[model samples]
Target: MLPNGDIVRQVLLGEKGVCETVSSDALVIDMSTIHPLQTDALIRELQEKGINMMDAPVGRTSVNAIDGTLLILAGGTDEQIARARPILMCMGNELVEAGGPGMGIRVKLINNYMSIALNALSSEAAVLCESLGLNLDVGAIKVMSGTAAGKGHFTTTWPGKVLKGDLSPAFMVDLALKDLRIAVDVARKTGAPLNMGIAAESYYAAASQDGKGRQDWSALLNQVRQQAGL
Candidate 1:
């Protein structure tokens, strides 16, 4: 985030003053991935000068860049996306219009959270498999590949939320906490030990307590990242 913030300062506010020459007709699309709040600040600054901006952060890696098949998660108005679409198409194969300014980064953070968390989960599972002396290739890989956690792509539609960068709740943290608490209670009564469900209850409860009661459940993924020290 520091490096990203430095990029803004150097490019937009530095003595070289690139933004100073921006025409009123210019649409300044910031393709760098940075904090949503920082994007808001940039938007405000550019607005005074009559030059609009879009927060269109690049997705995928350097290899994709070389082939011009990068995915750009853009946050701006429909008009903005339409205006920039042709230019974007030249550099990227996909132009995902996420939402207004800040939305792209929000989506990116949530997507990144899942990626980081899942990688950690997989690494830990791999260690367990190694310690237990299981057949790492077939036993572990094939088993996981067949499970819900691995193959539940269409069954679990997190992309609808994560890609939109919309954290507005279809299921609020408070409601999720209440439901999880009830689930834990039912498990206790039935003598069913829901180990993972119990852990999730703690996460939901903590998120609710943090004033994210009205936020999307994935917003709690930030807490997961923090707890994992990532």
Candidate 2:
């Protein structure tokens, strides 16, 4: 009963399926990543037949699964989730009760959106370095990773540097523009149009041509502020 969302719906609602087969004491847990709305509907359907269920989706590598270290995000009531904890713990090293009903899958979707976007952004950073004929070394990665573009980065930190007019080179304007150019090319090749990314690229290009190429990339924010009369 751990198929995808569509198949789960078909099996549960299909003729003489879970609705008919499940006893009053049965507590069926579904481990599928699906739309919250659909999970809501399924919950209602299951309630009609006195069958309890939980949306408990799992993530991490296949190796993690084999090692019983997957992270499980679950949605259900306190009692229901408590009942499922022993089983969940056996399959995962971490288990989060993401709230009631469809909340688990909803959280997963939001997490997926950020992770997906970050991957592209990360790739863009690498491509930018390549285009600038810069070496993609560990220190470069650390610098980029320290910005808002990666983990352990702080938006406040970058903004602080810019506001204080600290234009020292953690990364330079020409380098930033080069990365954005490669990011744009990557997006185009993947049939993904990057509207804001392209605009940022333009800003960095202008800054570079204005003899700011050697300055910190964050200095481009100053250029933007000047244009806006800020």
Candidate 3:
């Protein structure tokens, strides 16, 4: 079962439910974008039940999911994951075996930190370009989609969505905050400082509290606008 972990609390529920419902011998692959601690807890619960659990969180867009071109990071026993590789292959073009159990989620946490950081950078760039009357949508598009530094999906879509005030949830603000929280936890675990992550999480938390939790992450621009009294 594909237990999506884009939201912390919901992702936890999904993981737990799947762990409880499935047979002990069943292979449970959790692809949620949630915290590593949550994933670790779920994995432990599954292991106690004799269920094979792997943190196989997905990356890339929904279109990628539909097209079977997602990038998957998998964590589990080398032997267990070897058996599960075919299933992952069906859903993704790249299935990276990221060492033992929980490592997949750990890696995804770091990946999300980078994504949130880049998204913040992208929003600032878009705002700057707009302020400068440069209309650099096309250029930003090229830069964000083309540059290694701008590889995240938010750069591919969020700017225009923000400009048009279309905050519908392809991915929502709450989910983004959940991922940010996950990144914060990872930072704490590694003893790494994350000033930018804290700022971004605060922004997302504000957006969520503003009743835009279910709205698309692009709505963060509106939050910024509202704060600027625009």
Write one digit per residue (lDDT tens) for candidate 3, span 171-214: 88999899879867766665555666788889999999999999
Give the alpha-carbon lDDT of every model. 0.74, 0.78, 0.75
State which candidate, 1 or 3, has the greater lDDT. Answer: 3
lDDT of 1 by residue, 1-230 (tens): 13495688578867766687767798878777677788888888888777788877877878988899988888888888889889888788998879986677777767777677677666655555565567778656889887645764334435656346777887777887887787567656655555666677888887777787898766777666666887
List all candidate RMSDs to the true structure: 9.1, 8.0, 16.4
What lDDT tens digits, residue by residue, belong to model 2 across residues 84-128?
Answer: 999989999999889997778887887777677767766665665
> What's the TM for model 1?
0.67
Which candidate wins on lDDT?
2
Model 2 sits at a Cα RMSD from the real structure of 8.0
Candidates arranged by lDDT, highest first = 2, 3, 1
Clashing pairs in 1: none
Point out where model 1 deviates above 4 Å. Answer: 1-3, 152-154, 157-230
Cα error, residue 54 of model 3, in Å, equals 1.2
